[model samples]
Target: MSTSDPYVDLRSRAFAIAYQMLGSVGEAEDVMQEAFLRLHRTQRDGETIASPRAYIATLVTRLAIDQWRSARARREQYVGEWLPEPLAADPSPGEHAETADSLSLAVLVLLETLTPQQRAAFLLREVFDYPYTEVAEIIGTDVDTTRHLVARARRRVRERRPRYHATRQQQRRLAGRFFAAVEHGDLPALEELLAQDVAMHGDGGGRVPALGRPLNGRQPVARVLAAMAPLLARAGGVRFDLTKVNGQPGALVFDTRGLLVAVMALDITDGHIQTIHSIVNPDKLQHFGRVGNLGDLVRADPDPTGDA
Candidate 1:
């Protein structure tokens, strides 16, 4: 990919829109490829595009909307909790603090509650900072209708959004302590780090065992994590690497063979962990790296004692 390549210049912006809209890296990349192909075909046909950037944005948004409609049904039928694919934190052009927040796994989960059109309108206006007139044009709706869509989506997001915001340093420090506790099975330390109302959501996608419902409150979440830590350690070959997921503090779990087993994203706020999102579904982990067979690993013989 040459820096001078037009697609190279537009990839970041186009992917930001598509990924936020669909919450699936694979699907967003598909939309981006299709958009680029369309742009190329149009140029070959001697059609003039006044603004290639805007045209690609519109193409990606509309395509993502269509993809989301189809994906929603599959999600409804999904065996276990559905979560957006975990995104590795990589700096990209035009990605400011606000843009990163909107890309967080927590916000993506809230965006799932929105209708396709509402999600598109809201993201364009709120996250990407697109004007109302341009948003209406992109979504093929009247300005008034677009406003209504954004308004409804905004209200819903506001109601569910995290009330406390943590600076990056605060998040990293808190998350470090949280993961350290989990690894050492320190129940008290874990409890101290978690918020009173903290919740933990796991997405195993029915391929592996996971909590069928979210575990709420500090005590329950702490106990479950503490118990599991020793079990994982005894199983052998399990390692945890701290990294950023969707611009927030997170950790990646790998098996004995160093294949990815899970991606955990911590929602830290006000110096405590507000929520914990663990993605164990292999399908979702594929985008991050080689996914280990979590089921097989869990089924293997346990060391009976926490030994290497």
Candidate 2:
């Protein structure tokens, strides 16, 4: 790679690496900005860096690790479950240079369980294709140790990662079915699509009332969905626009006014809905564009007379 293109061509690549490491668009962007400042300072100070791309990657990686540590603390005290801010990802086919191969909403949630160093090591080596030697230097460890960290991280993640038994189209079909079931309050239908031990998570961040703990099991999860479904029409009208939430089949919910409301992503395992990741946190949603008040799901009835 040419030195000059590092500033322009590698911009998106930098964001991809940071996003994979930090899992927050806002924070990743911030890391990139800080990295730009550092690069400028180095250049202005008459420093001669051999490779701008590697230098920027190193800067972003270290910064991201710091951000992850800081954010992890706040997340521990977050009002409710904390989910990575969702993004509408562009279509990526084949082994694209920017492919965060296993990066998804659910996978990121799993990544959260890995120690920051382990996560950093795994991402640097596995996702970004950084050589083990470079990965070690980036995370400040020996090459052999970095290899072990990546191996251990991979093992831990594999133990928790979903088998991905369903194709994108199949997953989308299931998502559509589940959304429809919720919209119409079809409890039986909801149950049919959910895995026996399906899990549901909601992130309202206390700005809105949301379940703090995950709801597990098909029956309980289904019941909650049936109850929450009314929140849709209660908004008078809402749009469930199909979107790829973190590279998975998901939707961008909008109220009647065309404002983004909730961003939902699903994990489908064995052809059944296994997990639902819902982000209603206004703070998080603010970066998600626009959304309506989820608290209003109770007041407005989708159909008061029970005619529909």
Q: What is the C-alpha RMSD of each candidate to the true structure, in Å?
A: 3.5, 4.4
lDDT of 1 by residue, 218-259 (tens): 988888888777567667847788888987799998889989
**Model 2 root mean square deviation, Cα atoms:** 4.4
Global fold similarity of model 2 (TM-score): 0.89
For each candidate, the alpha-carbon lDDT, in order, equals 0.85, 0.79
Task: Itemize residue pairs with steric clashes in candidate 2.
Answer: 260-290, 260-291
lDDT of 2 by residue, 73-97 (tens): 8888988677788787643564453
> Could you tell me the lDDT of residue 49 within candidate 1?
96
> Residue 250 deviation, candidate 1, in Å?
0.5
Model 1 ranges off by over 4 Å: 1-4, 90-93, 300-308
Error of 2 at 7 (Å): 3.3
Q: Which ten residues in a row have the lowest lDDT in candidate 2?
A: 299-308
